[model samples]
Target: MSPSDVSEADAANELMRLAKTIAKHNKLYHAEDTPEIADAEYDALVRRNNELEEAFPHLVREDSPNKLVGAAVAASPLSKVAHEQRMMSLDNGFSDEDIAEWLARVRRFLNLPEGEPVAVTAEDKIDGLSCSLRYERGALVLAATRGDGQIGEDVTANVRMIADIPQALSGETPDVFEIRGEVYMAKSDFDGLNARLMEEGKAEAVAKNVAFDPAKIRQFANPRNAAAGSLRQKDAKITAKRPLKFWAHGWGVASSVPGETAFDVMATIADWGLPLSPLVKRFETLEQMLDHYRHIETERADLPYDIDGVVYKVDRLDWQQRLGFVAKAPRWALAHKFPAEQAQTTLESIDIQVGRTGKLTPVGRLKPVTVGGVVVSNVTLHNRDEIERLGVRPGDRVLVQRAGDVIPQVAENLTRDEEREPYIFPDHCPKCNSEAVAEEGEVDVRCTGGLICPAQRFQRLAHFASRPALDIDGLGEKSIAEFIEAGFLESPADIFRLHQHRDAILARDGWQDKSVDNLLAAVETKRAANAARMLFGLGIRHIGAVSARDLMKKVTRLEEIGVLAEAIEAERSGIEKLPGEEEKKYRQRIDAAVSEVIAIDGVGAAVGHSLADFFHEPHNREVWKDLLKEVKPPDYIVETRDSAVAGKTVVFTGKLETMSRDEAKAQAEALGAKASGSVSAKTDLLVAGPGAGSKMKKAAELGIEVIDEAAWADIVKAAG
Candidate 1:
């Protein structure tokens, strides 16, 4: 053959090969929980194939992987349902600003009046595979997975097993309706499944060196992967084996709907027995909606199901119709996603560290990986149980992901090496050489070294100076590490002694006089920090920021916390001897005391116990004593006449007159009134400055008082 002929044949074969490879990878990723390639690698392959197809349009084949959704539909017993409206996937937004831009484009296209408030309903965007169900006359007619935007495979029988998705709707039902939702496995459920696998001895054993070990059955990489695999099973019984849950997010189509508002429609759906995301909030304006998003982000870790981000939709049906559909997604709705929680990185080493509570935590040091733009080098292995379950050993290839964008954790071990040695739980603490014992009903094996462990000291110091703890500027993790390395700082009290070595630090390599001065200045600023900040900075095992604040509120003085801790401990010991009435009273008192100690909005029992334990510990008290000699924290402020918002319910709308919307909300929160989203009779003031939109009109119609941003500022100033 000629050179040109050979080249043509080679290109054709290459195209075919790429298509097959891409399709196989997609199957593994989307249907099987077993990804053959990393996301970056997969993206590169798709991009390359797209470029090739674009360059040679005539060569494109209908069955090419570039044109397909993913793998073929799973061989399930469920009858397939053809969708009335195709389940299209929405484009993702990575940041708040990205969402704002999307909203702006929608507004611009719709020619919405400037300064008109756009009411949006925000709900948790469940991290799971998308599925749609159709019901006719209250009875479920069809169930299908969102294969591609245009086509989907039916899985009616398999979906019927999901108890949360109602077989029929209640009351006056629509003639035809379509429900859209995500199918997911709870983290706890996933963990439990893995645990059961381990107990049953179905888990793969660690390989000896030079021997090949197969991948473990217990590991599913992530919840999304696990859920997808379960849903695609040939047997309905197999799908049922996985703890799958369905949460209704919205509707695709509805005939003869009774409600004027989307919320009303959702209420009907919830009444009909569809599980809805509990985090849904209806806001009157964009500001309130954003605030709700922030609140959800703050509380995301505590949620039962996984959420990638928040989804916002126009609350009013009329407005939604007015906005209409764009390309694949609706113009009236936008998905405002949180930063990516999962990331892939090369595992460098796995080291053990001791916590303040003396618990040994395995920390995996990785090649710095960026998730949601934050660099993460270290992730928690959780416990010895997790180590054994994952069959992860040092130097093995692993995937790291944050639990909920807060706590870093290892998601999977990708390399299937049977010869890899099993990680044995240490009998003694790696930090202090003290005996490590697993507590009853607990997974953590703790060291008995208490506060003396250097590793624990370093961890505590770093935690103490964190933003939510002491918030001491210039006293970051790097500075703490450097100080620890130089043997200049150890205990919490050592922070105040930095002045003693200011010259030495300044004289050291990579250090200058100005930097040294700044460090000392930051240390001085923290000396007068609030009681809550100080308490949190101490690095008590269970005492988190909220608990520290709660403790501070009840005790008023740092020293008084010790006494309260002792009293609580004594009361707890004598709980069995008390009369019913006395026990009730004692319980109330204890509850009140505990509440007061950790009364911050997000604080809980775990944090309270840590705080109590810290205060009661002789070593911690001794550290506190030594620390007090060098630096005294600010006096506790029990009562103040200044109101955060003076009991007034305030609503902010449109572009602010002076500060940004976020700044205005922060100011409002700092002052005292509940900053609300919508206009109602309960609303005291509607801050309608420049660009005030539908919220201003609604506020006026409802007879709720309205004020400008300047007026809102004045109110806050007066309260102060």
Candidate 2:
């Protein structure tokens, strides 16, 4: 989503959602060793979060992903180790321009002049597990995983077996040092390990005299996962059997002086017999570093281990310390990541699914293909327009891109020119067979079924009990869905009858006597609710709280609105627009029919038509009548202060230059006058502005007191 399209409130809500999503992925990847999405998809989430935060900085939440590093080690099975130094994550950049901008920012922070030679070290960022090995007097004493960059899981026994991780240092070493690096498995070793696992599972099943099921064999998704799963074992013997390798990237919690430059420290670590990336090099210019990144990317495919990007760090440790960090990443270092993973797969089929709000979304099924170490079989088409834009159909070869989005998109339809029947979007709801129509100037097609549509009923009920509607406490979205699934709730009326199912609800899981009683008590409190709130709770198309209250103020009772709806329906039907009817004549005919409904301020022909159509629907009418039987809404009333215009029916027409139509009505209300939308026998005064037209003429015909925008402003001034 673009930043311009999102408001502060929407950005705040999205940031909250992104924080939870990123945290979930972090736990799956770091703590549990099971990742749901590819690294690119996860990165996309973080990118979106960063974009929103940049756009609306004030709305950045406390729990934002930017403030977090890795998953907490609380969920791990192994013992915990408190680290002396926190392991920081590096900020990521995906393009040459991004790297250049990063370098510019570093120079700005250091107050370095333009074109200054800022030396930096670059290395391939390996996709593997992060481990911290602590050495006391040249001997490996403890090894721990980087969990939340703080306390970590103690894997000292597990790392002791890996030959690549030396148990004792061979060169001059510090009295106390904690070296941080990656535990990785090579691509070839990962393949062989997966094969061996499947074969061993088959052999064990044969030994047990059971039929071997290959589907039940669990294999790692990629090399990174293989290394993580193999290393994080409770039994070190299992870790010893697995081919795991370790390489030092940097050091943490060190006592003695090692090197002033990052590259020099890496040289000392290599001298201490720790594995290091041979491709690591130092560059003096941004251009040289970016060029080195490109070269490393070219060699990425042929590399022994999986590398997603190139990490660049300031050569001088003093500059790194001075630059410090922001949120969770160091300002002096950045990882120039690779682009999104793309793979071509066949578009098997397309399916339309209706969301809670009745939005019909199209999802495309794909032939299982691996992209960025994850098997992708489904992609969201978003809407009908996207499908038409792609011209995608079953059997078409489509290039799916896992470009940092949770759901992969159809990047290109390779067989778009192939002779095939074009996919047709359904005009009816799949759940209820109701006519699905897209609103004017809208892209999404929605079902008009409202409460009758099973897909929308859950949300409808939840909204009905929401604060804006009946304000019934204890009936949240989750509880409402649980009630509906348990057959305890189907409509808003069923909420009042939940007392009958109190025992039934108590019998089910998670429902106690006190909670059930509290819910029932809250529902019982709405028996004598406000007429406008009750009407708004019905989830009608055009009727809102203000419009509902306006209609109720004129009609008095809830039943009268039904009668008025029938009246408008009958009047409009008799004067229905004929074929070849002129626009003016048709407008006059409709205006005459819905004159009574339009007379109410804040409501117009839209509300009249919506009410008529809603009352005409058999299901809606039945539900409305059923809800009324359980609920008795009071007549809407306003206690107004005494004023000159008090108790007078005032009608406003045409363009109100000084104030909005609603503002005019609100001023009239403040003066104790009843603001109306039409000039009629009951209208005592008419406030006319430019292009008043028919209303002004009608007021003259009815002999009502007429005034301009200036005169209305005087009346409000006099009231003050």
Candidate 3:
């Protein structure tokens, strides 16, 4: 009633709202891969809350979200795990200038000479939930999510669902070792999922609102949200359905090991069956590190998953220890985030596309939005289920935002009219008018058009010409698509016949003499590709680069493999009798055998099944046979066993006073030994250099033999 009373009421209401806002933001930014507001907006809310809390100390609640790192784990059937070393969060830098300042601080703390080179390793700061995994005697013992940097919830069961993580180490097992990483959703999987949601009739208002979609209602907001939500699920089955992936980005604790450098540590982790981040790069100078950051930003859109920023850390463990911690985060590392890649756009139209796999994907044709310097007109709608859920129809007003700032997506419907009819998904293929069918146990409605459909054929041809496949560099996706549209290229086999169109292509607009020559050169270069790469270029369903490699290892050439796969399929009466063991075991054996020969650790059954199925398809086999006439896989033999190192587990830790860590690991691998980073009892030998940390102590405790740089040289010389 009085002025003072009113002020008190306003303060209380503001404090309550701040707490709620912070909680929601934490869930969005940390748990969910999506953040509704920009970082500045979230920071403003937090800053206001801090000022108010400082003014009203008594008003500070015990459960304030500001003091927390992330939300609680999901209700998945995962066993609780407690981290031996707490998984602490890193402080962030909003810009390149911010990163430079952080580096300046690091230099000041170390009293380093001006412009002195500081070895830095830059890696993708994956947008996902933080987690730690523990291994004992080579066996996975625990998996936990980073809670408050002090304690974490256990999710071992859910973690086991990820095929990238090894249940057992490769070589000598450690007494105790912990590897830390981020769990995330692959971009492809996320796209597929959103598409499925659109078809299910549970879409929301904003792309942020789409978090409420029924398919993901129980899941988190974005990939990061999905990851955290999946990890925290009380039921393992729930987490399994989310298709979470792990990328080892860092380490927390290891009882014992030898290796002096961060690179050595990562090499060891990779040997232990952890999928390390692909973006990790070593730099000799701060300038090079900055360059890498820029490169990462440029390549962000091309990456298969989301990265909020680039994480820079001292390459050597000794340097990291010398740097130590500043307040809460490590002084040895910094997170450099790129500018936000989100924008508001009007929904001009919505279109449906049929994929090479026949799955229908919904794409939003937006009113040309500019985000982070890129002009985006189309955003992925995910699936028909998502359309129904968002209640989005043609002509509805909408807001579009890019997930990870690369994949443009409809964030949500900004405004809609009840008079507009809901966008109905076509029951037939748009390209061929074939009957579209949704398979049992599948989320997408697929067209049975196969290679006959124009869209599928074009996509397949484009994929076959991709850089990693046949490597027809000049045959860009746009060029391939255009050629297909112009009736120049029709199928994967047609790419070989492109010589016939040289004059025609040269006559076309923008087709200069140099361009034509480049295209021809690219095609010629692909004629003698390695078997694995050729198989990948085929663009078979579920047959990815990894599977293609696996298929190659089974048979020396494409012809033999095609015949073998056909014979195996012909001998079968049904899917049950297709090959070898039960469908699952048969696929697992193929994976294990292929992985063993290629030395590609962690290749799983899913990849193997996809390869086998592809090879068994009559149409696919016929296409391959025709293509093989023009292109031949190189006749090179991959040695599966040459040295004891081939299967031996070797752990490297501490500083290598002699050879560089990378050189050491390479030498070990050459000798058939699996060179690892951390030290454990299973570690055949701990290569200790000066300044070895806890890993050295653990190796000593475990009675694992410890060797210096000289001793390692002697061992290598003796083996040779």
Better of 1 and 3 by TM-score: 3
Residue-pair clashes per candidate, as listed?
Answer: 23, 0, 60
**Which residue runs of candidate 1 sit more than 4 Å off their true CA positions?**
1-28, 35-80, 202-218, 342-720
TM-scores, one per candidate: 0.42, 0.58, 0.44
Tens digit of per-residue lDDT, candidate 1, span 67-115: 4554444333455455677665454455667667767765664456788
Model 3: per-residue Cα lDDT over 1-720, one tens digit each: 222333432444456445655765665555334555555445556657766755654444433443455644322245445556556667666666767777776676566777687778899888777878888877997888876565567888888888777788887756888888888887777766655656544544364464444434442235555566666777888777777888898777777764788888888888777888887988876678888888888998888887878898888787676565532367688877665556776777778888767778888787876764335667667677778778887677776654343346566686665577778888899999988886432446887767788778877777677655676777887898878877887667678788888899998999998999888887887778777777767665545554455456667666776665554444332333245457555443544443343332323333333445666667766777778778876864565665544666787777665555655775685566767767755588778888888988898899887778887887777777
Model 3 weakest lDDT span, ten residues long: 597-606
Model 1: lowest-lDDT 10 consecutive positions: 1-10
Off by over 4 Å in 2: 1-6, 350-365, 370-393, 402-409, 416-720
Candidate 2 backbone overlaps, count:
0
Candidate 1 accuracy as TM-score = 0.42
Off by over 4 Å in 3: 1-318, 321-348, 355-359, 367-377, 395-408, 413-421, 437-447, 473-488, 498-525, 567-602, 639-648, 651-720
Instruction: Compute the lDDT of residue 395 as modeled in candidate 3.
Output: 74
**TM-score: which candidate is best?**
2
- The 0-to-1 C-alpha lDDT of every candidate, in the order given, reads 0.68, 0.81, 0.68
